[model samples]
Target: MTAIRLFGLAALLSLSSMASATSFVGTTDMIGRALISTTDGISDLSSSLKDDKIVLAARDDAASFVASQGEIRGARLHAALQHIRTQAPQLNASDLQLAEAILAL
Candidate 1:
């Protein structure tokens, strides 16, 4: 009985973690999409990112733009972002850092 309770607790924790993570990701995606949608803002952002190490951060924002401009296009852009992130952990870290900086801006 005690073992069963522990298993349930662990499952609950895992689900909670997943929900929290998803919420964070969704929020980030929304913000990124917003910035990328603004043409002048995107140009400014690109300039700001020039000296920044995570230069590829703009790609995600670009993908967000593509997604919003058209449904099918957005789906493909989303897939591309997922693929790039998953396939290149090291490269993704720099990009993530650049994204964090952009968010701060």
Candidate 2:
């Protein structure tokens, strides 16, 4: 289990753009915590993210958004965020948070 978690963390790091450790650490921690959280809406969204075609199609946008810390809201990323908000109105996480979640998936 520890090996699997380490592999997952490694995979996550590979997917990332190698942004400063400080910035991604908090976001990575948030994504890790969120994945195990019991929050209904976010849980649903988090699971759905794995198969979300819209988000999948916007992987580059998500990477950019996360790397830029919400500074770069690419068009597809914006649309994906809108889609998530529409599906889970109760989820109060900011755009950067949502982007990190999407990127983590």
Instruction: Compose the digit string of candidate 1's lDDT tens values, residues 75-98.
Output: 433444455455443342333333
* Residue-wise C-alpha lDDT for candidate 2, range 6-68, written one tens digit per residue: 999998887675556667898999988875563455657889778878888778998987787
Looking at model 2, report the run of 10 residues with the lowest lDDT sum. 35-44
In lDDT terms, which candidate is top?
2
Model 1 clashing residue pairs (backbone): 67-74
What is the RMSD, in Å, between candidate 1 and the native fold over all Cα?
A: 13.6
> Candidate 2 overall Cα lDDT vs. reference?
0.79
lDDT of 2 at 63: 94
After TM-score superposition, the amount by which residue 74's alpha carbon in candidate 1 deviates from its true location, in angstroms, is 41
TM-score of each: 0.38, 0.58
